[model samples]
Target: MLHARIVRGAERATSYEVTLWALALVTLALDVVTTTYGLEVGLAEMNPFVNYLLPTLGLAGTFVVLKSFALLVGVAAWWTMPSKVRGVVPLGLALPWGIAAVSNTVLLAGIHL
Candidate 1:
C-alpha cells in the first residue's frame, strides 16, 4: 500500500502537514490565477529542474509532472519527515507565495505597483 492502512483511529495530518498542504494549495491556486492576469514570466526564470524536463515533455506534460512531484514530496514529508523540517518547508513557500498573492491582488484591483 502507498500509505499504511489505518486501523484504529483515523490518520490525521499534523500541524506541519496542514500548514504545508494549505501553503501548497494556496500557492498553486495563486499561480494559476496570476498567469491569467497579463503576468508573463520568461522561460529562463523557470526552475532549472523543470526547464530541463520541458524540452522532452511539452507544456501540459511538464506542468503535470511538476505538480505530481510536489504532491508526492508533500505527502512524503507529511508522513515521514520531522515536524521541524516540515514546518520550515511551508515557511519557505509562504513568503514568495504571499508576495505573489498580494501583488496579483493589487494588479487585479488596478493599482499597479
Candidate 2:
C-alpha cells in the first residue's frame, strides 16, 4: 500500500512545476532540432501559418521566443488557477510536448512514422 504525503512547510516548487518545465525543455529541444534540421515531418508542420512565419528569426531563435512566451503563460496560469484546474493545465501541455519530442526524435532518425 502507498500513501500521499502532505507537506506543511515553506514555499517550494511542486511536482507540477518540475514536470512541466522538464517537458517544456524536452519539447524545446525537439523543436530546435526539428526546425533547424528542417525535418518537416513532425507536429511543427501542422501549423502552417506559424511554421511559415517563424523562419524570419531562424528556427532556434523563433522557437526560443515562442516557447518562452508559452512557458511564461503556463507558469502564470499554474500559479493563479485553482488547484483542481491546475492538474488539467499540465495535462493539456503534456500531449503536445510528448508528441513533439517523440515525433521529432523519430523523424530525425529517418524513421518515417
Candidate 3:
C-alpha cells in the first residue's frame, strides 16, 4: 500500500509538471503572436531589450533568439531544481508572458475597433 501511494504521488507530480509546462508554452506562443501582430500594426515594443534588437535582428530573428534563450533557461532550471520546486520555473515564465499577451491583445483590439 505504501509503495502504491508513492507511485500515485509521483504520477500526480508529473502530471502537474506537465500541465505547468503546457501553460508556459501556450502563453509564450500567444505572447509571440500578439507581439508580432502588434509590431506589424505599428505598435511599439515595450521591452527595451527587444526594442533594441528590433532594428538589428528584425522580427522573426528577434523572437527566435529570445525564445531560444528562454527555453535554455527553463531547461536548465528543470534539470537543476528539485521536483518539489520545479513548478516555479514554468509558472514564472507563464505569468509574465500571459500578462503581456493579454495586454497586447487588449491594445490591439482597442486600435482596430
Candidate 4:
C-alpha cells in the first residue's frame, strides 16, 4: 500500500508538471503574438531588454532569442530543482508572460475599439 501510494504521488506530480509546462509555453506564444501585433500598430515595448534588441533583431528574431533563452533557463531550473519545489519553474515562467499577454490584448482592444 505504501509503495502504491508513492507511485500514485509520483504520477500526480508528473501530470502537474506537464500541465504547468504546457501553460508556460502557451502563454509564451500568446505573449509573442500579442507583442508583435502591438509593435506593428506602433505600440512600444515595455521591456527595456526587448526594446534594446528590437532595432537590431526586429520582431521575430528578438522573440526567438529571448524566449528561447527563457525556456532554456526554465528547463535548467526544472531539471536541477527538488521534486517538492518543481512547480515553481513553470509558474515563474508562465505568470509574467500570461500577464503581459493579457495586458497587450487589452491595449490592442482599446486601440481597435
Candidate 5:
C-alpha cells in the first residue's frame, strides 16, 4: 500500500507546480524592486499627490506584502511535497495570512500608527 501510494504521488507532480514556483519568483522580484529599490514605491505607499489615499495605500501595500509571502510558502510546499500532501497546500497558504490580516487590523485599531 505504501509503495502504491508513493507511485501515485510521483505521478501527480505537474507543470502547474512549476508555474506556481515561477509566480513565487516573480512576486519576490517585484517586492524587492518596489519595497527595497524605491521604484514607484513612494507612489504606491505614500502618494502625496492624492492626499486622501495614504491610508488606503498603506493598507494595500501591507496586503501585497502579506500575499507575496503566502504565495511563496504555497509554491514552496507545492513544489516540494508529494501529491497527497499538496492537497493541504492551499490551507497551509491561507490560514496564516488570514490570521496576519486580522492581527494587523487589530493592531491598527489600537495604535493608530
Candidate 6:
C-alpha cells in the first residue's frame, strides 16, 4: 500500500504556478515571435490594423490559449495527483520553465527591430 503525504499549502501553489507560468510563458513567446517575425501564415499578411496592434492581438490570443491549458492541467493535477506529490512536482517543474520562457520572450522581444 502506497501512502501519500500532503504538504501544507501545496494545492494553491500548484494552481498558481501552473496558471501563472503558462500565462508568462505564452505571453513572452507570442510577444517575441510577433515582434521579431511579424506574424504571417503562409503568405497571408497578418499586419495589424494599427501600429503595434498585431503584436497586442497576438499576445492576447497566446495568453488565452496558454492560460486555458494551464488551468485545465492544474485542475486535473489537483484532483488526480497523490496528495503527497501533488503540488511539489508541478511547482518544481513550472518555476524553472516559467522563468526560462519569460526570459526568452523578453530577450526575443527586446531584439525586435
TM-score of each: 0.49, 0.59, 0.84, 0.84, 0.35, 0.38
* Residues 48-68 of candidate 1: C-alpha lDDT, one tens digit per residue: 775687679855677678667
lDDT of 3 by residue, 6-110 (tens): 666655655588797899999999999999999889998989999899899998999999998998999898889767667667877888999999999999999
Q: Per-residue alpha-carbon lDDT of model 4 for 19-89, expressed as tens digits? A: 88889999999999999899899888889998899899988999999999999998898899767667768
Ranking by lDDT: 4, 3, 2, 1, 6, 5
In candidate 4, residue 104 scores what lDDT? 99
Clashes of each: 0, 0, 0, 0, 0, 1
lDDT of 6 by residue, 1-113 (tens): 12222454665565565565465455545544544443332222333342354456565565456446665776686678766446554565455446655555555456563
The weakest ten consecutive residues by lDDT in model 3 span: 6-15
Question: For model 2, what is the error of residue 65's alpha carbon versus the real structure, in angstroms, after optimal superposition?
Answer: 2.3
Pairs of residues clashing in candidate 6: 5-84
Worst 10 residues of 1 by lDDT: 5-14
lDDT against the true structure, per candidate, is 0.56, 0.60, 0.87, 0.87, 0.50, 0.52
lDDT of 2 at 74: 78
Stretch of 10 with least lDDT, candidate 5: 36-45
lDDT of 4: 0.87
Candidate 6 residue-wise lDDT at 26: 58
Better of 2 and 4 by lDDT: 4
Worst 10 residues of 2 by lDDT: 2-11
Cα lDDT of model 5 by residue, 1-113, tens digit: 99888555545534244544454455444543444333232323333433354356554565465566667767687778776556445544434444434444444445443
